[model samples]
Target: MALNVALLRASFEVVATANPRFVHRFYEVLFERYPQTRPMFPASGMARQEEMLTGALIAVLDHLEDAPWLTETLGALGAKHVGYGVTREMYDWVGASLLATLAEVAGSAWTPELNAAWTEAYGAIVSLMLARAAT
Candidate 1:
């Protein structure tokens, strides 16, 4: 869990270093592939878009010390997203696309350590969220 937190922090640092062009590229690639997610975002701008991504990175990193807290937070996040028409299936798409973007940005710097950490972290996130949905 600590490693997962470190990875989230490290990945966000890499992402934050990117120019705005990279953000646009990421959104473009994601939305183009899954047009259905477009409506979940602001139709007119990227303000909330940046917040959501940045917030998720920070939240995940900040909560690594407490897996239960991470699970709870992600459950709330999932519930909110559900209101936006984001289904459980959609989370899988989000994970894939976000990881792809990270890999693209990190290039050679993306190692097994980071990959495994993020994978485990995201798994926990999704599991808790789905568990919440069942409740």
Candidate 2:
């Protein structure tokens, strides 16, 4: 299914004001659900990682129509992840954690449709990442 960009963007805006907490919640869920992945990140770089994640989300959302830029940027990010020992399987864990965090942050605003949209978007991103990794 195609991404519901408008819905995803609107839902994101609803939780944008709580970005810091959202990012924190994301990592909290991710680590809690998949403790094995925790070793991949350093304790000292969480703040910077949060900033980069938020920035990357905004960049991806804003430039969703720019396929070339998105592909290059996300591919580069995927290539970088290869050096960090990120496996393709980890993408599923991250995606689930992300959706859970979004639901927690969005509270009553979260719906099945919104969840599906984000899932689709995340799948697209992971596909790009995996594609890059395969090269």
Candidate 3:
């Protein structure tokens, strides 16, 4: 499943300006929907965490065309996540929460086509992450 890079980038640009709030809403939705996952994050330094999340997303999106770098970087991230106790099943929860948050924040800019593209993109990301973790 190929991603609609243009749409993703454009929509992200719209959301990026409110990154702190966006990240806050993302975690709020994630924890509200799946309370069990809350312990995975620290109680403090959320600002830093938000920065990391947005930074990572931007890096991945920017390097989407660079397969080698993307794979290597995501692989390393996946391995690190494994150490942090992130399981394969959790990826689905994260993806759903992420999409929901994006839709809510994107407002009218959100469309079925954009949803499909993000779904595909997230799936691909999780697939790579899981594959790397398996080793």
Candidate 4:
């Protein structure tokens, strides 16, 4: 099934509304799960980290209804990430991080429907971004 654009946006809006600590928790879980990403981000950052994550989240979610843009955007993101030294494994790790963060702050809103929606949304991104990174 196609992913739900509204739910995806709502989920992001929900997370963004949370205390800034949610951002900290997201990054902590993400980095702990994939220490490899530590090099992708600065060593000492909280605001910068939140800004990047929140912005990226908004960008990805906003384009959920546009497949061509999603592919192109993700591919570009993949190419840019090459400079950050991300790997195919790291792309997969990023997906894991995304899901983990959602689950962490999702509360009752993180239902099966939300889970499927984000998984598909993130998977579409990972597929293209990782493929571009591979080449």
Candidate 5:
């Protein structure tokens, strides 16, 4: 399925503007819901991790239409993640946490359309990452 780029960008921008703690909220939800994943991250240096995630999200959104670049980048990223002990199942948990965080941040602005847009976008991203991780 195709991603709703416009909706994704607009909603992301709104969320970013509305919540300065976007990434923090994501980690909070993630750890709260999937405590098993908590050990994967360090207690300190989380600011750097959060920064990386924000950068990655921006890059993915910016290059959503660039399949070749997305594949190559995410492929390498996926392979790297494998080294970091990221299991394929963790992606689903992350996706759920991401959507939950976004919905929470977006508050009244969140809608069914935004949820579907992010769902499709995250699914595509994970599919690429997993495909390369399997290699």
Candidate 6:
């Protein structure tokens, strides 16, 4: 399925503007829902991790139309995950937590359409990541 790039960008802007701690909330929701994933992260506080995630989200949303860049970036990222010990299954948990956090942060701006847009975008991202990971 194609991603609703416009909706994804607009909804992400709304969430980012509404809550500056969007990635923090995502990690909180992820850890809360799937405590086992916590060990995969650093305990020194999540500042760096949060920054990386926020940058990645913005990069993906901003470049949704650029397939070559997306493939190169996400492919390398997926390959890097192997060193981090990220399982293919963790992508699903991360996607769920991210969408839930976005919904909560977007508040009144959140819609079923927006949810589907994000879901589709995330699925495409995970597919690229996992395909590279398997290599």
* TM-score against native, each model: 0.81, 0.93, 0.93, 0.83, 0.96, 0.96
Q: Candidate 5 — which residues are off by over 4 angstroms?
A: none
**Candidate 2 at residue 87, lDDT?**
90
For residue 81, model 2's alpha carbon misses the true position, in angstroms, by: 0.6
Which stretches in model 4 have alpha-carbon errors above 4 Å? none
lDDT of 2 by residue, 6-102 (tens): 8878898988865646887798899999999998998677988888898999898887777888789889899888989999889899999999999
User: For candidate 6, lDDT tens digit of each residue in 11-130?
Assistant: 888998999998999999999999999999999769999999999988988889999999999999999998898998888999999999999999888999999888888999998887
* Predicted candidate 2, C-alpha RMSD: 1.6
Better of 4 and 5 by TM-score: 5
Q: Which ten contiguous residues of candidate 5 have the minimum total lDDT?
A: 1-10
Tens-place lDDT digits, model 1, residues 3-41: 555557877687668644455666776898889888778
TM-score of 6: 0.96
Question: Candidate 4 on 36-111: residue-level lDDT in tens?
Answer: 6677677777678788867776787777777788788788888888877776677667777778887778677778
Superposition error at 30 for model 2 (Å) = 0.5
Per-residue lDDT of model 5, residues 1-135, tens digit only: 367888888999999999977999999999999999989999889999999999999999999888999999998999899998999889999999999999999999999988988998999999988877873
lDDT measured at residue 20 in model 2 versus the true structure, 0 to 100: 47
Which residue pairs in candidate 4 collide?
none
Descending-lDDT candidate ranking: 5, 6, 2, 3, 4, 1
Q: Output the worst ten-in-a-row residue range by lDDT, candidate 4.
A: 15-24
